[model samples]
Target: MLKQLSVAVLTAAGLLLPAAADASPARFLDQSTIPDLQRAMDRRQLTSEQLTRGYLRRIEELNPRLHAVVQTNPDALAAAKESDTRRRTHSSRSPLEGIPVLLKENTDTADRQTTTAGSTAMLGSRPAKDAFLVQRLRSAGAVVLGKANLSEWSNFRSTAQIPGWSGVAGQTRNPYALDRSPCGSSSGSAVAAAAGLATVAIGTETDGSIVCPAAATSTVGVKTSLGVVSRGGVVPITAQHDTPGPIARNVTDAALTLSVLAGADPADPASAAATFPKDLRLDRNALRGKRIGVWRKGHTGIDQQSDRIFESTVHTLRSLGATVVDGADVEDISWSVKPDLLPALLTEFKHDLNAYLAATPGDHPRNLSELIAYNDQHRDVEMPLFDQNLFVEANATDGNLNDQAYRRHRAAATGIAQRSIDDVLASNGLDAIVTLSGLPASPLDRPGDPRFLSSTRNTSVAGYPNITVPAGFAGPLPVGISFLGTKYHDAQLLSFAYAYEQATHARQAPRYLPAATG
Candidate 1:
């Protein structure tokens, strides 16, 4: 079993100060999202450099305890200076000009920072280029503040892998409860946003990596339809499923980021069909007269507290003039827990990862086999918590995209996932479907049982759009409600989520409690 670090060990690297900050910037920066920060810059109340330094200081003072951020960009202040210059010259690049953002470590940056995906194996080497979305953010004048810690190898390393554990950066703790799991592979991205380390963050998901953690940490996560954002520079799980999206404190901020991050790229053919909406402004009345499918069957027995919040959310939707249709499920899509999904993921992981390694300019392991061997050689550091059995399985798979079985399973997965949502929407004539994001953060002391239900599975498998907005509290922890829609419905999903968010105003800034106690 993986050993849990003691409170002393957890706080050894830094002071365990209360999450409340008394710093001058905390008043202006603590709970500020993108628009709030932008307005502060526009009013000349804050400079890009000042804002960047405030976040850097927060990361330095607090990251030791939470381990939410892995490293700060050495030239972050310099980037912010450039943004200040642009703003002074009346030549701002985009709406995101001068805003700070933290990216999940899996995203590459051609700078002093290394993109290791929380693994030491890829350390000491810089990527030859920035990820496609990173380039977009830089072009929009966003300061690349730092990299956030995540589950090593995006939580695909071990079948028993813990959500926030990483060899490179021990573990990322929930801002709400330091001892709880930050439920996604994009743990750091969620934590960083919730802790006010950045105005926004970017996270990639093959499935629950984005929304799950966003839910657990009380932040907004958008899992754009596959190819809505390019997967070119991200480490892969499967080309069919991997896509990068934004995580922020609100739907408008997430939507704004998506507008900047989405577009076609030559490197990823899937983006050819991608389309983006120009207007991201949220209409608070967007839910009016909307027919919403409430999928309550999945989350009933797992957590009563979350279920109560879900029921309350359904009531809120009805009060907002939505016609809530109960009992909507994708019974046709049985791939969620089936054995066939693993083979498809394994086959694609080997093929896509090999291509990525070959293209990256480094002396790192060139493929899955070499990576597995690297882990075996460095067992003390790499395999202390859990072994790389998932890597082993992927390495053993016949890495052929053209193989008949591979093609069949991959096609079947996509088709089934798509049809599942399409049929539900068509039959019920629903605008969007709602469900609990997942269970609140689990305890990190041991290998916990798998969650019985998750809203991410159906939409993830179908390559459709999904958005998570903080619903309410499950006791001391946060819970989120998800909105799922058919493929290419990202804009509508965002609009709907935005409406609910504006009405409820449920998200709360984390208290950074030491641990739960009676």
Candidate 2:
């Protein structure tokens, strides 16, 4: 199955070139952050068109092996030329000017590329307008490089589906180790960012989608407080927990990207009630005199190497002038029980997805029921590996957000999650809670992989901000530590993450090894 998938992806990418032609021209792009690229452009040492073409060339050379990018923007060079013109006129829009960014396939761009969420069912579903976040990136003079492949329907399609597999694009391989999972459903975004396919990428997360992939690929992922970044035209998984955030090679790039994306949108009601921080500048001394709480409940005793690395991280934090509080776990919440989350997601997925399909101008399934039928009809293409049981369950729901049972379940889940994080913070008098973002990537194509462990659910359910940075490596695989903060505290969390990232500098460019190394 893996071999076949690899061939299919290579064929789909049209990467059957000679050995000489396969050599990448953008080796300098490796581990390059947005600020570094901006400075080069500012010094007239580089043009946006040059940077954009370099990335495009890299994607053409490497994407066949990693399957990170599913589509390349036809107008990307033109947009870069426009950015170059603006710079020539001394009218740069923002720090992101002339930077190339990859958008997760689920993000709507209203361009030549299709926003299919990596599913064949929505193959032609081109949204009428760009997602609010995409509009923000464009207005900031960022070039839309392409759409990165993702787990089909952002991993909401089935319970037994593979993490990075999709009907539209085959599996996305981890750049660090091709045989290991890239994690999902933001798999391609993180893989691309880690491999320098782009300067930065935007990924949406309902739960661990963004952070898990980022952690697995040794990149920085910021899952903003739900309303901090608008989800206006992005494909939905439940508006209550869905958000589009940045996945970059470093914390500063993620924070800078978030500043551009954070704004209220009248189209999304959730954004209206949220207050975005105006100043997103990070202070290297942000951790000094700050109380940081360590939540090691699920992180410890799992992997000895990870535990040792985390202990070192805690020591580093204390040495950097932080007051580290041990045993500040969110004891009120039970990780074993999630009675309301599934049903609530099913109800909300049905309701929200229907609305998104109806609003999108395209010839595709218009609702959950139609989507299920479409999958059923095209079983060979859509469900060859796993059945769409989640879609069937969602379709069974009444698709009403106003249903009493759904509303009650949603409220209970959100309340418990909020209290879990909030109570711990308040009782400990800490600025943020830190834990392992996720375990290292398991082997790809293993359906019931037990090595996966997630620590993003509480923050995801509470609709708060969470940022994950590379803490260390286990063998050739990367481990990330997450800093979770209360709602609307996105800026503060980024500052803390930035400070930690600068001190440790743990992230490394991927080597694209065939397997993990000791």
Candidate 3:
């Protein structure tokens, strides 16, 4: 009788509450930030093992429906135990001393998890070694919980592809609304962090991968300036634009991840200029009395609801003492880049892919030719939507990355984007730019996203930094506002974003429903 009474008490507390919980819905743990978790660990309120067990158990119960996680580390528990030992020994390393972090599949992890980049062709493939940025993560004492599924080859595999579908990991369901899209190719990392699968996750972006998924999942993600975070060992779409960044449940945590991930690396030449931008926490209130340029274009494709939400975001920023200067006023602002974007992407894809394939493990169609042939053989599965259009177009190009045409296009596109985007900020005496993130990615029921118009493109094509914080929700699902800026302004960028996020406090956990559309 006494034991039965004790069991009932535990049930009311929401401690997983048995198979048929008699209490309210799973309250889970406190579901807070990395710093909060670290303080709790410091006070012995929670052990790393306890925290990790809760996450693993939540995955066992919830991921069957969400499909947000692609793989789990077999050593996760053992790592958690080691973290506990280190804590007891008074040797805590950093804020993430015992926190679990998930890495996008494209980021190499020299471990049990395979870096397949969410494609079956690379199934069983493992990266030759840990990517430089990934190695930095390990040094900060983060337990590698697992790898998050991403859009195949970071969404470079197909032109008319679904946002979250990948042959290796399948379609990761949107945690906020099951049938709705999570957006990608950082879909898994964003969703995993939003759904409490881990404290934070690292995601890569050549374009919209980080911001889109963050907006879709009610989290914060920073798409750092080129070279701020080393791109070595990460699967690439364009070496000129590719970068890895952080996705977390909140802006502060994302800022923390940014600090650890940014550094100079001998492996990636781009890192020569990346010796800074790791001090995001230094200026915690960068938004005070600062000028922020409001982007004039790229919100036209948004839904009506997101427009209203964006207006509120502007008001919120203004109230925080930011001078909101409007328009795309700059030198060469009219100069466009997409005319050469496809050519540059294709050329880089072929060269970079061949290098990555040679480095990683696998036994399947490799190289641009073999992959094209493989796509031809599996047309029903691979080409049901988009033809191997990119593959074919790329096949027609020169393998020479230094060809005159390739070099010219690369120079023109990157120059116009970088110069104009920065000129707008400089001319306005602005520290950053603000814009609606995009149409809160239309539902996932269809084959593709609803012709989404994202502002991250400018920063992406320009190789500048951009971050998205939870602006607020249109309904039950979340939306984000982007902060974009000049070259290597990663610290200033994070400070502005973190201040905005703290002021708004506008994040919530996903309800894991069907669709939030009205």
Candidate 4:
């Protein structure tokens, strides 16, 4: 399966690239920001077709080892040509114009690429239209570079599963360390962004999917408040928490991408009430007077090096003229216990996934029960690493949002999560809460669940915005610090993260080390 996928990806790359004699200079592609690329294009030094081909070549070169991209868009070069024509006509749309962006495989696109969600059960499934966010990207003149691999079913299929493994794409390796997990559902998005396979990528989070992978891969990820970016046409884990956001090598790119993606969508009811700032440009001085809260208890304590890095990060914040409030942990909370979250998520998954699959075009599983049965029938490929226990559990639910027990759990879980973040911020008088995004990426061969130290739960359950930026390194692996804020604070969080990122300049491109060293 892995060999066949690689052959398909390589063939796609071959089709996109120009012949060697006709190739353009692409040495400037590495670590190039959106503004930098735009400036280069403005100077007549580069074109969108060249940039797109450069990325396609990189994907072909690296994806054999990283498994980051599952498919490259057949229309990518044509889209780039269109962007070039628009630019020559002085009608460029947005900051993202001509940027090549990867979509996580779960994000539906009405094109040749399949929206499989990294599962063979949906191997040939197609969507009737572009996902709402994809529509926005196209409107902004961004090229849909390709579809990235992800944890199968967005990591909802099995509790025992590896973070970046999927039936279709195999495993996605961290760019920094091939032996380490990418900490995903958004695994490929983060890896591709970090490795410069694309200008940026879109990822969905239902808890730590976005931020966790961003931290692991040493990239920037913004988990916009739920509904800030519509979930329509994306594979659903649960509408209550799932949100599509940008993962990029820098905050400016992520923020710019978010500006394009954020808007109310009629197809997604959750987006109806959401609002966003007209401009999301970053302010380098945004953190000067901000009061940032530090939740020491949120530290995972598994990596002493990460703990030291967090302390250093706090000092850096203070040096940036920010007031640092220590020990601002969420009060009176069962930080270790989450009794209601599971039942609520399971029920919603059954209901929401059924709806999404039923609407998807092509012949495939149309409901949760059908998906489970398909897995059973193809156990060799789908269950090679882990069983679909979560699917079974979700299918056992009443699968109705109106069920009294489901409603109770949903309300209680969301309420507790909201209060946890809101009360802490209010008590501390904070602009944002800061903590380690999680422990550095764990080795893939280690048994049991990976130890994650992030405060992802509080923000995720409350449907708030969370941004993770590269803080520093723990040995050869990178660690990230998170800036989390209440709902609709997406722009503010971006500003804070941007300031910190500029001040520190801590992110380093991956060396693709075989393993980490102490």
Candidate 5:
């Protein structure tokens, strides 16, 4: 009860007095996720039409200024109409049957909306049908609320770039601190979830895309192991690193989204291990006496602000009866992984993306070389804020995925990361490792690019599961702490997060701001 009261107090105060504190219609409406809203609908308070209209109204009032939502599905109202029809005529829903959700624009919706990937090159093209993820959402009765704005090409188009800027969708401001940035490429998806534009939003991550944006936006984000969630129809990044995860205001919402979207899809070959656990919502005492190893390296020298917040989080976890064991540095953490990281990404990007693009024929550049050439051709709009240095470099590399050098590099990289994780857990008999999820929030854009260290690689290279929960604030900007562990430890990590959340309940909703200041 104390924890619940704290969450309510924090939510109320934070929503009303958020960093930057910009008013948003989206934040004012019934912004709960599908499950919470479903309960309200069941109580005969908000009909599906009313729910849909509220979000539409929010989108209308804010999208123009914030540029968070670009293309709302034309069929959204009709879909809501259908949901209302069912509610009045029938008795129950098929899970999220009437829930309105925003797809990250990278997700193919197969509706009137086109998946532009926030780029002008594919602005007008529409997929022949819904992407597999969208199809899953539809299968569970979710309304394709709209296509959200995202970092163009999911942030693969440029290097050292701004977070929320897109050629087609313009710039999506941080809902809490507009000047501070919402981080990307899942910027719009996380913002939509935070500002009440949608109940839930789906964001794809290659490196820090999903988790960074979620931390910056004060939402819950899960970055599954490489093959856990299907990457079937989502836009391509490095196939070895990409997974579409859930971003929501709470862990339960995220878990619920994961449950709805999990399972095997023949379309995405990597999703074979997508089996979810039964009874995902664990008890509040799940973390008592559980081993929690502290990852000290990831947080040692980042932001002074984030470090202070993470300290509070560690203290909180210890107070809740969790056995806290500190330290992550060892001979193996990144011993020889640094030299081989870029080569692997370049090789995988060129190989996997080409394969995925061949399936989706379009007028835009279809391959890595072509994309680099296209950027060279039109460097003005695409390279105005940042250069395509990463793409150009990757395009120049040889993708010898089958060669001796590639094999050695991949082996060494994974070996170091995985060994470090194992050493930490095994030495301490730990269930999960906790660390600062790190706010990769947007720095103020200027003549140069906004810069920050990428934190996703620590677990990504290891092929581990990671979950981020809201920890506390760094000057009103949200920072999160993570619980991660060895391969296929999704349930264990979730339970740890749930217990921490139940104890701390630290998350607060965003109040869209035009700028940030005390």
Candidate 6:
């Protein structure tokens, strides 16, 4: 009875705000999309400052409970004012002119906000400038609302670490059920988007960081093809695997955000040889006559709840004119048999991170060893839940790229992953592969016991493109279906995902409920 009363009280307090209030035509900012907001602004029914203030109000009301937003941009309103000025002058930059977007804490912005990756050791560390992607987002007129909390050090601190619990910001709860985990290292970004705290958010992925969190939170996540999005100012995990991508509540929004974020960067040599799409649009009939491979090889350990959604998704695609092939397996891919991923990441992390630190303008720890030492010195705060074993391991390793063993492992893994994906696509004449992105959010008490199979390994290792769209729910929690394609096939992948999303509008706004009753 007390629990029921508590829930009623919370709901009455406007925790589960509606999409539209019957008393006024002012649509809920949480329910408004980038284009929708722009239309409202153009119609004179809304202004950039008004929209920004609405979002800020929502953040102030819910952030304390969700812990999704680590900080709110103090200048968000001012930036929105500038956007309003641009609109008055007919000098709007892009479609994102007044849209507010949240960024993962690891993404460096040369503003007052700190880019700490949710670690105390790098709390006050400031970069001289915004990350290459941030520069593009700003140029396109998207306001950097603030940094979202992430798994400390992008979940690389320890093998037993919690996904969303950062040393600096604590744990970000699942907005749908506050007790459930918001998977990371993109936890806060996923939660923020799911809760409608931002128009869209950016999350960086070395592996499952972007997709896993989006799936868990019922948001759309686009893990772009390696080199499609520049990683110039993003804190390092592994340059070979790390790429910043978009997380949003729908496929179109994610696609729109990606359009702004994707491009070549001379500073990021990995993207130097990459191709960016000249045009991207949603075609509802995109799945018509397209052959998509169902990657059964990657479906191990999928829970019954998610499998049910996956089956329904397959039927939905078939109904929409897609030829779905089940039991499609990749040939010559030995990801499970190989131990090359961690080794490669360790090598690159030690080298890439130190280089970034050396370039950063701050008095913080400048190397992995110093970072490790800082954590030890601040053990109660930083290492309360998990130790820095991964840091120690990376620090001890000789990670020189010139080393013969390092080169061998990197080449071998990259080659195996790439060949496996290419061979499967060619053999099946498949445009893309579909699989369960992840299962529902798990309870935070046992953070290590993840319930679903992650589709991150193959795509991350192969440096290919993958996108996740909400498929359905496991009770109150969400499950996502992933669409993956060959390298530089981001457009095709997005089209496929967008088509599925249109066919099955599975995403729903989070309710900020206290817990999952089921």
Which tens-of-lDDT digit does each residue in 304-376 have in candidate 3? 7777877787787788888888784333222367788778878878888877776667685567788788778
For model 5, the local distance difference test gives 0.73
Residue pairs clashing, model 6 = none
In terms of lDDT, which candidate is stronger, 3 or 4? 4
218-250 per-residue lDDT for model 6 (tens digits): 998989889999999999889899989999988
Tell me the tens digit of each residue's lDDT in model 4 across 295-383. 87747466788889898899999998899998787543345326788988999999999999888889899899999999999999999
| lDDT, candidate 2, 1-518, per-residue tens | 22332342244332122213223323345545677777767776667887777678778888999999999999999999999999999999998998899999999988899999998988879789999999999999999999999999999988898988889998999998899999999999999999888889999999889999999999999998989899998999999999899999899889889989989999998998877776778988999999999988767788888888899889988988999999987653445337888889999999899999988988899888889889889989998899999988998999888889988888999998898889999999999988888777888966423543457888898999889999999999999999998998888989899899999999877878888755
lDDT of all predictions: 0.84, 0.86, 0.77, 0.86, 0.73, 0.83
Model 3 ranges with Cα > 4 A deviation = 1-31, 277-279, 282-284, 300-302, 328-335, 379-386, 446-452
Ranking by lDDT: 4, 2, 1, 6, 3, 5
Off by over 4 Å in 1: 1-27, 332-337, 447-451
Cα lDDT of model 1 by residue, 1-518, tens digit: 00111231233332122346543234345445667667666766567887787677778777888999999999999999999998889898887999889999999999988899888888865688898889999998999999999999898888989888888998899988898888769999999988888889999998889999999999999999989999878988888888799999888789889998998889889888987786667799999999999887657577888889999999999989999998886553454536567788888888988888878887688878888889999999999878899899888988899999888887777777788788989999999999888877778875434545557777888889999999999878999999999889999999899999999999887878877542
Between prediction 4 and prediction 5, which has the larger lDDT? 4
Task: Write one digit per residue (lDDT tens) for candidate 5, span 237-311.
Answer: 776678888888877778777777776788777777655774576668878788787776646466887777778
Q: How many backbone clashes does candidate 3 have?
A: 0
Measured with C-alpha atoms, the lDDT of residue 423 in candidate 6 is 81
**Regions of model 5 farther than 4 Å from truth:** 1-33, 89-94, 298-305, 328-335, 398-400, 439-442, 446-454
RMSD to truth, every model: 6.2, 6.0, 4.0, 5.5, 4.8, 5.0
In candidate 2, which residue ranges exceed 4 Å CA deviation?
Answer: 1-27, 332-337, 447-453
Which ranges of candidate 6 are over 4 A from the true structure? Answer: 1-30, 297-302, 330-337, 447-452
